[model samples]
Target: MINSHQALSDTVISNGYCVGCGACAVPEQSPFKILMDSYGQYRAHMDDSPVFGRTDSSYEELCPFSSSAPNEDDIAKQYYAETCEHHPQAGYYKGVYVGHVAEDEFRTRGSSGGMGTWVLHELLDKKRVDYVIHVRSETADKDLNNIPFKYQVSRTLDEVRLGGKSRYYPIELSQVLKTVRDQPGRYAVVGVPCFIKSVRLLQAQDPILAERIKYCVGLVCGHLKSAHYAESLAWQMGIPPSELEAIDFRIKDPSQPANRYSTYAKGPSGEKVVPTNNLFGADWGAGTFKYKACDFCDDVFAETADVVLGDAWLPEYVQDSDGTNVVITRNSDIQLLIENARNDGRLALDDLSIEKAVQSQDAGLRHRKISIGYRLHCEKEANAWVPTKRTKPSRTLNPRHEMKRQRLRTELRDLSHKSFLVAKKTGDLSVYTTAMTPVYNRYLIQKRSFLRRTYFLVKKTLKAMIGR
Candidate 1:
């Protein structure tokens, strides 16, 4: 016979089904709740705080980590169409990119352009929702990358501002579910694509969630990186992990150029200004540490979210670096609220087309189809079937196309070099320069000053004459 304690203790790396969403640790009031044990897996534990109770099971039912599930095909179809017509928030099916609004209340102060926090603030300040369930860091030392999370609501914008862009590491949904179970309040949630899907799945199983969850917001994600990335970044900045006090990923230094990403942190010695590109790539989608689970996600755009937000990546947007947010509204009320905010001059407005929006995240979108490969792999593993590689058709490769690719790479290499030389001349020994110093050291940094361009031009001339 299977022991009940054995089942409760099933949180493991391999055998356990923990998806690492932050649902379980949500309710600050739960008598018993979920926690990350020594093994890095979440298991339920007793928490008999008066705040924690067996209140409405709404968050529980909405939890994707819940054991019960509906038919996959049905769920997939609904998500693909993105219409829950029976719900109160109808008319949210996909269409031309909805109108855009940049709220002054949220713009400069938020993690990105501040839309994510703004939305949460609106829900709470306007009394649209009782609480906002979002991820916040539990660790003082962020170098470990594996910090626990807490799900709490910001009663005011100031409170929301306090938790801006922590992007706490190793957050899981099971924690949020436990929080909601114990804390009885209407809540809105913000998460990555998979986390949103899990919430939807939970709602299917639990009726209480259908009533409790007020809104869902999604962030654009290509992959989830490890703590080591942060540690490496700090180490590059000459601030070893041990000496660092606080780190802010998105540091806005208006004095600097727009594309130049600045990361700010405090250390035992003092404050440091480090460039962000070294910590994370400008194009995050292209890098490794793309989560393995993300490989199986088709909802890259957060098709299920009432509203989705991400960075607006485009040539025109290369400058104006306070960060412009790309937002998609699936809910009419939210859209109207934004419109009103814009009309009243409480926000800045920008009209963005869906085509352009998709282009910003092109690299990540390609992985949506690739997720099917992962799904198939999982099924094969479950069935103990051998996996076989399928032959892929080769496209006609023209040397001209290959040349274009090569030229782009060459240009990027040159640009990267230029950035380094600029940093060296400016005497800005930032994380951006240090982490990328090796590459620049090997190949000359692109000084972009008259000297480097002249050298390139001379090289091109020599190549042209040789061809003749």
Candidate 2:
């Protein structure tokens, strides 16, 4: 809440909770830049350049954290059911959930097999979309040398490939929406669950957006982390943030026997690669600078997006891991594209049941469910669920994983108590304090356990080899 900064070219805010997910800080000449303030939290600073389009409050509306519209559950559900019934596609939705891995080079390079970008490329290549309104990164000039990358979109896959997974800090989708409105063409977009939801909500409110956007791709997100996540990672790798050249949060080891995962950064001297498990525990999933809006979000399955994609971090996936993406396609059109791709040998996939899909998500959470289902309840009633706080946990943890669930439940409860104490002491009881408590707590506990297990397994395997 830095009042000194006012909205001019684009409405920007100092959401101390920003995780530098690069949703805002895209390279594509946005009116705003994601920068770290004195408090160490990342906030969007309006780029004073003349090229930033006419200043408007519209960007504020696209923000997932502070928006004017009620979270429309009925529409989300109706869309979900309708997509499944009449136009079901393979690897689309898991039950009512919508998400899938994209079939392209991006799948191997992205955070989770590059599915989000895959969808964008397909939409463009198949002529189903004239433009793909997804974010891409650009290098900063010496004037903004402190910043490494910025985000913008391009119609061609070549331009989109330039941005790759280098996150642009503080991106605003309203700018892209405005672009779509002006250009007047069908486009596909990739965004976090809430950002995609915002598009659906915006389309409902603004007829122009409704007519413009053709498809939505969602990333399976637990929470969005802050710039500190990047800072800390760079520090750990001995690459000062300013010296960093190229970075990718999730990098599939193309040369590894099994795309053994790594988080990579390129500095002036060379590259640094750290096991993906090492990065998962501390910040990306749950830590300081966690986006406040994500706590209240219950769309882990991305019910709003036409497709969702994430890493299939299960025991079976380790065999060939150059990158095995777990995709859930919610839109039939996108599904048809996938089926066609696989048939034509562009991609390969195995049939996954809905039960398996849920398991993939819960394995990371140790099989417990969070109760943000006011949306689901509202959908059943065919009404809008005003985005607000509710205390109940709706989704049940997988019953078969009861032992694991209990361990996670105990850890989460302890974390919740600690977070509550912090919130009460600060007296800043933002909705995230209540809404995200379960998700944040459960994620931390489960991820920690997963890492520990992976570590021991690696250690034991090495020991056995030595003994032999």
Candidate 3:
């Protein structure tokens, strides 16, 4: 046990595979402590005392990044192998759906169609779960420097509603998972793909958690942004990280497309609302403030979860400003709940074909499943102890263009963190932007159409000749 603990500290933590899910810190009297670092991302720090054994979990078993830990396939096979249809991208699905909550302001209030909270609310209403453990704005905390969002226990529909929208901020499960263990009651947890995988890993070993955590509701993620992501966006809104009070990552715009949402930030003097695209780190693909662990992760649909919900980015659905949800259900109960809601006119939905479901997150799929091997190959070339992933290491990339793009993404990810720290130190946001501009410009250039590239090249040559 101690060796496994030490191994986790040395490999996953040291090698940058840790996503700070806090699963390792959940056990009582644990040697691991979850702390937010200077970069504004949560991480587990190991202490000297090898204290543990209260539950059937270990660092090796609980961490989603641990090579020894059971992969999503291993965990999902236990809960769903017998019943669900499996896909490389969708994981296990009993059904696929696309639409929004029609009954209330759920669609209007939420980041997407509001199926995330609607599902959590149904669990509470049906008495299926005594509490919904989800992320909420840190309004309850009096501390001025608190992270804007936190994992909290929501016991009522109203409480659940308070945590409605998607929070791209970093949050950990150590505190809330401990609450589940200390108190005895059914609970539903809301989190992204990797976090859900960690929960499934922990639940496999911890019977207490397995029994109490009634449902694992998942959010489809492009990738997780660090706490710095919030700071960067807020800072761009004239609310610097020091005075950063609160932020809303997704504010729907009816005039524009549903995907064309806005972000709102508040500070001491005032508040500002800006179109998300206007923000520096708004490009989800560029992956600013992204944890390196996210690049290695292949599960985009939250496969091991009971049900995974995310935006229906397909052309047919993107026009609706209210937003639509692409839901993949592995658990029969979740499928039944959503189906009943649709039948009763509570939810406006239609059966989404599996291919369309995959199409919604096309770019994310390419990044995770297609290009992941090159990332792993890079890790090996550096002789780093990379986490064992479903996607094996390979560099057999086609077209050469994709390889360059992947490399640029990795550069964007690493530089974003390092440059942000420099910016924070100097109190100049331009430090980060200056460092990122050329690389980001290169990334954009790589994505340019061939005709556009030719036009630019011709323009450059003509200008050079004119100068000569």
**Winner by TM-score:** 3
Estimate, for each residue in 392-442, the C-alpha lDDT of model 2 and write its tens digit. 433333332333444443344334334434443454334324644566566
Name the lDDT value of residue 36 in candidate 1.
Answer: 49
Clashing pairs in 3: none
TM-scores of all candidate predictions against the true structure? 0.64, 0.64, 0.93
Model 3 regions more than 4 Å off: 49-57, 140-147, 449-468
State which candidate has the highest lDDT. Answer: 3
Of the candidates numbered 2 and 3, which has the greater lDDT value? 3
What is the alpha-carbon lDDT for the whole of candidate 3? 0.87
Candidate 3 versus truth, CA RMSD in Å, comes to 5.9
In candidate 2, stretches whose alpha carbon ends up further than 4 angstroms from where it belongs are 1-68, 85-107, 140-151, 166-170, 254-260, 276-288, 363-468
lDDT of 3 at 301: 89
Clashes of each: 36, 34, 0
Tens digit of lDDT per residue, candidate 1, span 1-468?
Answer: 532223222321123334455444343333335554433333445343435234434433333433233322345456444443221111123432322235554556565577777777777777888877776655523531123345555455555555556363446665456556667788788887667777777666555676688788877766554333343455556766556555666776676544566766666677677878655333443332233334344455666677777776666664666766777776666677666766786656577666777776765664443333443344454653221212121232232233223223233333443443444345454634554545433332322332466688799999999999
Indicate whether candidate 1 or candidate 3 has the larger TM-score. Answer: 3
Q: What TM-score does prediction 1 earn?
A: 0.64
Error of 1 at 153 (Å): 2.9
CA lDDT of each prediction against the hidden true structure: 0.53, 0.54, 0.87
Measured over all alpha carbons after superposition, the RMSD of each candidate to the real structure, in angstroms, is 10.6, 10.7, 5.9
Local distance difference test, candidate 2: 0.54
